[model samples]
Target: MANEDRPRSKLLTRLHLGTDEPLEVVPFLDDTGHGVFATRAPSRPNRIGLSIVRLAGIDGARLSFEGNDMVDGTPVLDIKPYVPAFDVRHTERIGWFAERLGQLRGKLSDGRMR
Candidate 1:
């Protein structure tokens, strides 16, 4: 099947060095102290990141995708078909995010990870 015809997928990528600090605790965008696992802060113990994107097309070894948030030349570690049945979770608790969902709409990176 053509790439565009395929379903959306997930990319496991190595974060660029700009946000690759191994920080145990970092202030989230909201200025709350949170452990690395509790927030999407880029300074994790491991510099891996997961991005969900729509497959736009492929030419030879290059992949085109929508919903890209990484910089160009970002190293992709792996790709997996996005199966909502397995990836989606019906959770009542999202920890701190549960109370902060309303603030997510206009939030943007402030370069705090660097």
Candidate 2:
């Protein structure tokens, strides 16, 4: 397979989980039910994280992107092209996030997880 270096703006990256105790469940924002898998809580059992970032540019061996949610120096496990057809899902049931959608904008992470 030819390694197509075509400029793809979207990329899916697997990252090493940060330093946090593995939690089975946490109160969502201290108000909702946030079972570990139900919420994007950092402390997961597997200690692996997934993020979607915008591919900004390729400079020799360096790559930069926007929308990096991981901490600085976070180890990246893998990377793959983000194909919307396979990644995007149109589903009405988003579990707990469905009701909290309005709180997303301007909402910053509190140190509760720490």
User: What's model 2's TM-score?
Assistant: 0.71
Model 2 stretches astray by more than 4 angstroms? 1-22, 27-30, 111-114
Report the C-alpha lDDT of model 1 over 1-114, residue by residue, as the tens digit. Answer: 765666889999988764545555555446667768887765677878899898888899999888776767889999998999999889878887877778767765566533
Task: Score candidate 1 by TM-score against the native.
Answer: 0.78
For each candidate in the order shown, give its overall lDDT on alpha carbons. 0.76, 0.63
lDDT by residue (tens digit), candidate 2, 1-114: 222543334433344544455455564454744667777766666667777776666799777766666666666666777887888889879876776778778766765533
